[model samples]
Target: MNKPIYILGIESSCDDTAAAVIFNSKILSNVVASQKIHEEYGGVVPELASRAHQQNIVPVVASALKKACVSKEQLSAVAYTRGPGLMGALLVGSSFAKSLAMGLDLPLIEVNHMQAHILAHFIEDDSQTKPDFPFLALTISGGHTQIVKVTDYFNMEIIGQTIDDAVGEAFDKSAKILGFPYPGGPLIDKYAQLGNPNAFSFTKPKVGDLDFSFSGLKTAILYFVQNNTKTNPNFIKENIADICASIQFTIVDYLMDKLKNAVKETGIKEVAIGGGVSANSGIRKALKKAETDFGWKTHIPNFDYCTDNAAMIAIVGELKYKQNDFSDINVASKARMTF
Candidate 1:
């Protein structure tokens, strides 16, 4: 029992094939193989993504083990994302992790992809501060947008969630309308800093105070671009920065508003954010500003953990492993799962 617990984590929830090794609470190494093929199609193609995972997962896991200076035999268990993603993509990770665990006679842990994003904060790291219990977690990503109430390592409640398109989709779709390439969320964030946020305004959808809806916002943006370009063919080119800034501004503002409401309802002053969108510069700056303006504490994981990476899965695996939580040999992946 005194020996360190090592977990080999695998994540293939989407286009990224990730693997990581965690020693106790600290990450020893994390590696991700991103599928650039998705960029050509403007979004991930599930079949292609699964095939890429098949090709990349082995090398990625090997690299993680090598970098961590640990052999597969040293690992106490294998953890992998099991659901709420493309079925084919989820299968690649599940099948590999199951096989590895069985081969080693080790425990196999099934992790919720979304839950991993929230637990990522607990990964022992010098660069980040862990959130306290009962804090609010704003999870923003391409496929999900939810406010989770984390009361413990495993006890989490989704107090609020999107009714339609997730925040990341809103960002990417808006950027696409601007003629930006696939995975345009980051591009939107980059250009946002160069222009005024108020240069263009998009109305936030009228969803319930806790629930979010971004489909309408995407439609609004599409029309705005279409109408504008009719008058000036070079409209987007001339005002790309301002347009991006404005879209980013509205999305961040809407997210903040929901977080504020959650805090009010739960009386939880401590806030944490996770998921890919958490890396957006505007949201990070806004969280920093909230610490001063609202006297609230905030936590944001390091950039690497903010995205869909295996380190998060490893950390969650470590937590569940502590509780003796293990899945059976019959465990299967789910295309749609809930925390």
Candidate 2:
């Protein structure tokens, strides 16, 4: 621990195969190999995703170390995502990381995928902007929708979460209803920009407190599309942009409303957002508006770190490494893990 520590982080929790080398607290290189094979199927096929990770893991890790100008022998420990993702996908990274750690006679660190998303903000960079203790983190991703209270690097409390489907599902599923390709959240954001956000209306869910429910919104959109298309088959074609804008507006508003409630309840003005949905332009704009209108400080990660990536995992690794927190080799991957 006297010298700088180099921790290699591997994340294969989903469709993305990522690896990163963190020296001390700085991320030197982060490489991600995204699986486009799932696009044709309209969503991820766990089997295909796991196989793609098997194919990409080795080269991705090698590329990250090479880009960082670091060798495997110099690493202090190996860290990997352990849960809250597909079991097969998590196994690919966890198995590889465990094997490498054993081969190198180094320690192993296990990280929760969701926790790593929130910890991503701690990755040291030129931004020099970090959320202080007791900040609120809105972790919006494909599989999760949570509002966590962060008091320390590893200490977190999920004050709010989705009661049903996540917000990302709302965006992607809504896009599917509109005939967009898989992973259509970004495309929705793109089209929403060209249209009026208030052009159409969708019923927002009435989930009380900090918990959320996007299933209602998704159902509403589906029924609306079906009902309208019955009258005019070209309904979606003629109002694609406007429909996207309105859908995006509802989702963003739902998220912000719950966040405001959390702020009022916890009295925490420092807010940070992470996960894939954090990359949405509409959500980013809403957070910026909150900063000005609600007098809150917001922390948003760079686009590169917004999705499933090892850079975030590496930062968690660094934090645990400093505290001498190492996982035993027998640690297993979990598909659904809490905290």
Candidate 3:
């Protein structure tokens, strides 16, 4: 039998710095260090995020290697997120991976961050929900909203995308307007549980077929608050839950509407969702319900795997490595990496 290939993966395309070791397709260790510096600013500061990655990458990689008990010489290849993220953050990971690969004389794999997100479904230990080819995937995150058609490992196409703000960006911005702290998406989700989704009605923006536009929805919320507060200054405080529920419902509804249309247009049954926003409780529940309602199968990654991580990068890297897909040291990070 052939010895399984061991690969090291690095992911510093955003606020989190991560590293992981994988043997063949199985993950051995995954370590992520997140920067909390953005809390005071109510959003990620790109330069600060990059500086934090520079400081965290070395130690993070060391920890992953130690935990996996793997040596540099044993690594079959090194993989890193190549683009579609903060330029400085992507530079840190890409540069480190390139240097390490050069020093170790190993092949370097350039993994697209979004592609890694979709491939995250294959990283789970549970074998029952593996997605087959030509699958439909809805990838929602702070930076991107895309509906992808995965024909094969390397053959994926973006059939639909956001025209304005991403779904998660709407949640975060709404949370901020509601006086929540930075990284407000989770806060909104938490408070939403205590409120009624039907308490208020928010209009779903109509952009185009298979495309999304959250700008109108966001404006609607802003105007609603402005108008209501004119009558009662404490209107938001008095009806916080209902507001959250209403916003959450609108976002989920819009996502589902686009997803259903994509499935109908593509005529594919195997559907999956990934990226940071995929971890949203409302989105998860709605996707599951859609599966039953539309008679389609759904695949979602575990909570840990749903967010930015190196394991997903390693999984994508492994797939590429097997096909002898490698990148040169001169490969640069891209700010808008597309499928």
Q: Against the hidden reference, what TM-scores do the models get?
A: 0.99, 0.98, 0.97
lDDT of 3 by residue, 76-108 (tens): 999999998999999999999999999989999
Error of 3 at 281 (Å): 0.6
Each model's total of backbone clashes: 0, 0, 0
lDDT of 2 at 279: 96
Tens-digit per-residue lDDT, 1-339, candidate 2: 587699999999999999999986789999999999999999999999999999999999999999999999999999999989999999999999999999999999999999999999988876636899989999999999999999998889999999989888889999999999999999999999999999998877887889999887888999999999999999999999999999999999989999999999999999999999999999999998999999999998988889999999999999999999999999889999988
- Model 2, residue 65: distance off in Å is 0.7
Where is model 1 more than 4 Å wrong at Cα?
none
- Tell me which residue pairs clash in candidate 3: none
Candidate 3 C-alpha RMSD relative to the actual structure:
1.2
Among all windows of ten consecutive residues in candidate 1, which has the lowest summed lDDT? 1-10
Off by over 4 Å in 2: none
